[model samples]
Target: MSEQSADPAADLSDDVRLPKEQPTPAFFESKTFRLISLVLYLGGISGLGMVLALYYLIFFDSGMPDIHLKFPVSIGGQPVQKVHEYQ
Candidate 1:
Protein backbone atom coordinates (compact mmCIF):
# COMPACT_ATOMS: atom_id res chain seq x y z
CA MET A 1 0.00 0.00 0.00
CA SER A 2 1.00 3.62 -0.83
CA GLU A 3 1.82 6.00 2.03
CA GLN A 4 -0.79 8.80 2.68
CA SER A 5 0.12 12.54 2.62
CA ALA A 6 -0.01 14.41 5.97
CA ASP A 7 -0.59 17.91 4.43
CA PRO A 8 -4.39 18.79 4.05
CA ALA A 9 -3.81 21.78 1.75
CA ALA A 10 -2.30 19.49 -0.92
CA ASP A 11 -5.75 17.88 -1.52
CA LEU A 12 -7.48 21.27 -2.35
CA SER A 13 -6.80 22.97 -5.73
CA ASP A 14 -8.15 26.46 -4.69
CA ASP A 15 -9.56 28.35 -1.69
CA VAL A 16 -13.43 28.20 -1.21
CA ARG A 17 -15.63 31.16 -0.14
CA LEU A 18 -19.34 31.37 0.77
CA PRO A 19 -21.68 32.99 -1.79
CA LYS A 20 -23.08 36.48 -0.97
CA GLU A 21 -26.83 36.93 -0.48
CA GLN A 22 -28.75 39.03 -3.08
CA PRO A 23 -31.06 41.95 -2.16
CA THR A 24 -34.85 41.74 -2.65
CA PRO A 25 -36.24 42.75 -6.04
CA ALA A 26 -37.48 46.33 -6.65
CA PHE A 27 -40.97 45.06 -7.70
CA PHE A 28 -41.59 43.57 -4.23
CA GLU A 29 -41.04 47.02 -2.68
CA SER A 30 -43.09 48.91 -5.34
CA LYS A 31 -46.73 50.13 -5.07
CA THR A 32 -47.73 48.08 -8.11
CA PHE A 33 -47.34 44.86 -6.11
CA ARG A 34 -49.61 46.27 -3.39
CA LEU A 35 -52.23 47.30 -5.95
CA ILE A 36 -52.14 43.88 -7.65
CA SER A 37 -52.44 42.13 -4.29
CA LEU A 38 -55.45 44.27 -3.31
CA VAL A 39 -57.19 43.60 -6.62
CA LEU A 40 -56.63 39.83 -6.27
CA TYR A 41 -57.94 39.89 -2.67
CA LEU A 42 -61.07 41.81 -3.68
CA GLY A 43 -61.66 39.49 -6.61
CA GLY A 44 -61.42 36.43 -4.35
CA ILE A 45 -63.85 38.00 -1.82
CA SER A 46 -66.35 38.93 -4.57
CA GLY A 47 -66.15 35.41 -5.98
CA LEU A 48 -66.88 33.92 -2.54
CA GLY A 49 -69.78 36.36 -2.07
CA MET A 50 -71.27 35.38 -5.42
CA VAL A 51 -70.98 31.66 -4.54
CA LEU A 52 -72.72 32.23 -1.18
CA ALA A 53 -75.47 34.25 -2.85
CA LEU A 54 -76.10 31.47 -5.37
CA TYR A 55 -76.14 28.89 -2.55
CA TYR A 56 -78.72 30.96 -0.66
CA LEU A 57 -80.86 31.37 -3.79
CA ILE A 58 -80.78 27.65 -4.52
CA PHE A 59 -81.30 26.28 -0.98
CA PHE A 60 -83.23 28.99 0.97
CA ASP A 61 -85.31 30.56 -1.82
CA SER A 62 -87.92 29.09 -4.17
CA GLY A 63 -85.96 26.36 -5.97
CA MET A 64 -85.83 25.44 -9.67
CA PRO A 65 -88.97 24.66 -11.64
CA ASP A 66 -90.12 21.06 -12.32
CA ILE A 67 -90.34 19.83 -15.89
CA HIS A 68 -92.42 16.96 -17.39
CA LEU A 69 -91.89 15.44 -20.82
CA LYS A 70 -93.82 12.75 -22.76
CA PHE A 71 -92.34 10.76 -25.57
CA PRO A 72 -93.75 7.72 -27.54
CA VAL A 73 -91.49 4.68 -27.32
CA SER A 74 -91.57 1.54 -29.54
CA ILE A 75 -89.68 -1.75 -29.63
CA GLY A 76 -88.51 -3.42 -32.89
CA GLY A 77 -91.65 -2.99 -35.18
CA GLN A 78 -94.21 -2.90 -32.33
CA PRO A 79 -96.47 0.06 -31.72
CA VAL A 80 -95.97 2.20 -28.63
CA GLN A 81 -98.36 1.61 -25.74
CA LYS A 82 -98.88 3.15 -22.29
CA VAL A 83 -96.83 1.38 -19.60
CA HIS A 84 -99.72 1.43 -17.09
CA GLU A 85 -102.03 -0.51 -19.50
CA TYR A 86 -99.70 -3.52 -19.40
CA GLN A 87 -99.58 -3.54 -15.60
Candidate 2:
Protein backbone atom coordinates (compact mmCIF):
# COMPACT_ATOMS: atom_id res chain seq x y z
CA MET A 1 0.00 0.00 0.00
CA SER A 2 1.12 3.56 -0.73
CA GLU A 3 1.99 5.79 2.24
CA GLN A 4 -0.86 8.13 3.29
CA SER A 5 -0.26 11.91 3.10
CA ALA A 6 -0.02 13.74 6.46
CA ASP A 7 -1.13 17.11 5.02
CA PRO A 8 -4.67 18.11 6.24
CA ALA A 9 -5.74 19.87 2.99
CA ALA A 10 -4.77 16.88 0.92
CA ASP A 11 -6.91 14.49 3.03
CA LEU A 12 -9.89 16.93 3.19
CA SER A 13 -10.38 16.82 -0.60
CA ASP A 14 -10.81 13.04 -0.58
CA ASP A 15 -13.16 13.12 2.43
CA VAL A 16 -15.52 15.70 0.90
CA ARG A 17 -18.54 14.01 -0.66
CA LEU A 18 -21.78 15.09 -2.33
CA PRO A 19 -25.23 13.91 -1.19
CA LYS A 20 -26.41 10.69 -2.77
CA GLU A 21 -30.08 11.57 -2.79
CA GLN A 22 -31.70 14.69 -4.26
CA PRO A 23 -34.04 16.92 -2.23
CA THR A 24 -37.86 16.57 -2.48
CA PRO A 25 -39.50 18.25 -5.46
CA ALA A 26 -40.77 21.78 -5.02
CA PHE A 27 -44.53 22.52 -4.50
CA PHE A 28 -44.87 23.97 -8.02
CA GLU A 29 -43.59 20.73 -9.49
CA SER A 30 -46.68 18.75 -8.40
CA LYS A 31 -49.58 19.05 -10.84
CA THR A 32 -52.23 19.11 -8.11
CA PHE A 33 -50.48 21.82 -6.15
CA ARG A 34 -49.94 23.88 -9.27
CA LEU A 35 -53.55 23.54 -10.36
CA ILE A 36 -54.87 24.47 -6.91
CA SER A 37 -52.63 27.53 -6.74
CA LEU A 38 -53.68 28.60 -10.22
CA VAL A 39 -57.35 28.14 -9.39
CA LEU A 40 -57.09 30.16 -6.17
CA TYR A 41 -55.16 32.94 -7.89
CA LEU A 42 -57.62 33.11 -10.76
CA GLY A 43 -60.61 33.02 -8.44
CA GLY A 44 -59.20 35.82 -6.33
CA ILE A 45 -58.45 37.95 -9.38
CA SER A 46 -61.93 37.38 -10.84
CA GLY A 47 -63.61 38.28 -7.55
CA LEU A 48 -61.54 41.47 -7.32
CA GLY A 49 -62.39 42.42 -10.90
CA MET A 50 -66.10 41.83 -10.29
CA VAL A 51 -66.02 44.00 -7.19
CA LEU A 52 -64.22 46.78 -9.07
CA ALA A 53 -66.61 46.62 -12.00
CA LEU A 54 -69.66 46.82 -9.75
CA TYR A 55 -68.12 49.74 -7.86
CA TYR A 56 -67.47 51.67 -11.08
CA LEU A 57 -70.88 50.86 -12.52
CA ILE A 58 -72.68 52.02 -9.40
CA PHE A 59 -70.55 55.08 -8.62
CA PHE A 60 -69.81 56.37 -12.12
CA ASP A 61 -72.98 55.50 -14.04
CA SER A 62 -75.93 57.89 -13.63
CA GLY A 63 -78.32 55.87 -15.81
CA MET A 64 -78.79 53.18 -13.17
CA PRO A 65 -81.31 54.01 -10.44
CA ASP A 66 -80.37 54.14 -6.74
CA ILE A 67 -80.93 51.11 -4.48
CA HIS A 68 -83.28 53.00 -2.12
CA LEU A 69 -85.38 54.26 -5.02
CA LYS A 70 -85.78 50.73 -6.42
CA PHE A 71 -88.52 50.05 -3.82
CA PRO A 72 -92.03 51.29 -4.59
CA VAL A 73 -92.69 54.74 -3.25
CA SER A 74 -95.56 55.14 -0.74
CA ILE A 75 -98.05 58.04 -0.56
CA GLY A 76 -100.36 58.02 2.49
CA GLY A 77 -100.01 54.21 2.96
CA GLN A 78 -100.79 53.57 -0.72
CA PRO A 79 -98.35 52.74 -3.52
CA VAL A 80 -97.69 55.59 -5.97
CA GLN A 81 -98.86 55.42 -9.63
CA LYS A 82 -96.50 54.42 -12.40
CA VAL A 83 -94.57 57.17 -14.18
CA HIS A 84 -96.32 56.44 -17.50
CA GLU A 85 -99.83 54.95 -17.58
CA TYR A 86 -100.41 52.60 -20.52
CA GLN A 87 -104.15 53.41 -20.55
Best by TM-score: 1
Model 2 lDDT tens row, 1-87? 988888767866565446865566688798889899999999999999999999998887667655434565779977684443323
* TM values, all candidates: 0.39, 0.38
Backbone clashes, each candidate: 0, 0
Once model 2 is optimally superposed onto the true structure by TM-score, how far is the C-alpha of residue 42 displaced, in angstroms?
1.2
Candidate 2, clashing residue pairs? none
TM-score of 1: 0.39
lDDT of 1 by residue, 1-87 (tens): 987679978877865644564555599777999999999999999999999999988877575533211333668966466533321
* RMSD score of candidate 2 (Å): 11.3
What lDDT would each prediction earn against the true structure? 0.71, 0.75
Model 2 segments more than 4 A misplaced:
2-26, 61-87
Supply the global lDDT for candidate 2.
0.75
Q: How many clashing pairs does model 1 include? A: 0
**Residue 39 in model 1: lDDT:** 99
Question: What lDDT, from 0 to 1, does candidate 1 have?
Answer: 0.71
